[model samples]
Target: MTASTLARRGLGVTVVERSGDTGRTGAALSVPEGLLERITGLRSEQLPRTLAPGVQSWFAVHTALHAAAAADLGIHFRENTRVVEVGQDTDAAWAVTAEGERIHADILVGADGHRSVTRRHVAPDKSDARYAGQVLWIGVAEESAIGSRGWPASVAFQHGAGYTLIGYPLPGADGSTAPGARRLGWALYDSSRDDVLRGSGALVGSVVQHTLTAPEIPEHTFEELARDARRAFSGTWRDAMVDSIRRRAVIGTPVAEYVPDRLVRGRVALVGDAAHVANPMTGRGFAESLLDAESLGAALSSNPGRGDRTRALLHYELDRLDAVREFVRSGR
Candidate 1:
């Protein structure tokens, strides 16, 4: 989507990715209404039919329930493109090589990921990515598993001994088409870095075990942990949300990280989690990434001959720094 947006403005764009295919496997994340409205330029009438039915209400991390309307937009995900190296010359053009194929452009954008190769190649001296002492397990739960609508449809942060569990339903892909189900976001806390490296089920098992074995789970109340799948999800609500998590499914450990200083380097820039990743505890990554793409696209497209593309890049970097910081602080 970012590449297409930038390309429409006559900017040269070649998306280089490491994946051999578009791995559309991860659970859906949030896209804030204000950002969505601005980016897609759609009205309230256009939203309902365009959006998925699972989104019930717009709940904030610190605020009240509100209605959010958004425009219809599609993200064109490209696969099989892996960017291995990025180099900028004196001419201000970037030379990017991926899978032995080289492409030259006046600007580079690394929307790759947290362990961004472009970031490492450009800002080698930057501090290492740190874990936020939490590992998240995410998957879809059947509507049958959830009997009632106990909490808001958004994120619920359940804090316990040495950790926090964040639960939320991912819109649309709740498996409602053939079999009705809802996506569940579980952010469990872990003190050991070693445990996080071991992956999802281990992390979840640790959470279950923690709640069962530990006498006192700090900050986490039994009310948070005591949601019986049959009663709370399936038996109570007319439209119940259930557990979609399959037996022994691995929902990769989500370790939080961020880049506070900048969002780009030379011709290369970053969007999405590659640039600034917030803890899932905040539940704002998808919203922020979509915003970044639109903001960067607007800056690049609107300003022509304004001291080169770097000026726009710098603007994007500066604009997002404070927002990312604020989001991170709130999650903490």
Candidate 2:
């Protein structure tokens, strides 16, 4: 989003993507209509046709954004580039890739996710997002895999057996909303999974290490989740969860919360999850990330020169810090 916005503002952007693939799993995204247009000032025909509003799969949204950024000549994209170190001086900011290549720019913005390495340079004192003491077991199940007698509810919240399940009727990755083509996306919040998280190293000493993939999930844990699903839900929700569990398609992610005290240092600035990470329960993390990207671009554009780089970045930090802090604290 930052790349698109910056590129549209006539600024050159180099996006260093940590991974080349977009098959990542995430909760459903609330994409407002014309989001890409709003960010890039591009017409509908200029963006990917697969880009649509409403509830979308994470993969779908990413694919569209990738397409949009790639189409812009001002945006240079590097795939599978792991940035190990980020540094900045008065004249320029740069990233040292794992391959030992240093990519320099007038100003560097870190749009990296929760485990952002760029955040370390921006706010070294508070780089890690603290573990929120709960884990979310999330997955998307196809309608054909878990047939329902009627159309599923648009959304549902169920609680039992020390778990809270959030289920949503999601369109297919292809954006199909037909009864047999739609999918069910579910997130099972379980506070009792700290042992599993610690054992899997997904949680370490109050910080999040990583997500637990299906293959890493223990047999006993799967069995327990299956039973818990039965006790907690019925009909479509239960069926979807059981199907995903039987197929071992779920991912367990420990929630992390980060409230930044500062978002910029020298010529380096932080955006998205690198800046703030609110609890997912607020359903405002993604929206806040979008605003961060937009705000950063606007602030920099308002002071578009090397001489005013630090001032622009400080403006972005000051503009966002107050609200995002409230997001994490209040949501928790």
Model 2, 219-254: lDDT tens digits are: 999999999898878888899899888888899988
Best by TM-score: 2
Model 2 RMSD to the real structure? Answer: 1.4
Which run of 10 residues does model 1 get worst, by summed lDDT? 62-71
Off by over 4 Å in 2: 45-50
lDDT (Cα atoms) of all candidates against the true structure: 0.50, 0.85
lDDT of 2: 0.85
Q: lDDT score of model 1? A: 0.50
User: What value does the lDDT take at residue 232 in candidate 1?
Assistant: 36
RMSD of every prediction: 8.7, 1.4
TM-score for all models, in order of appearance: 0.67, 0.96
Kindly give the number of clashing pairs for every candidate.
32, 0
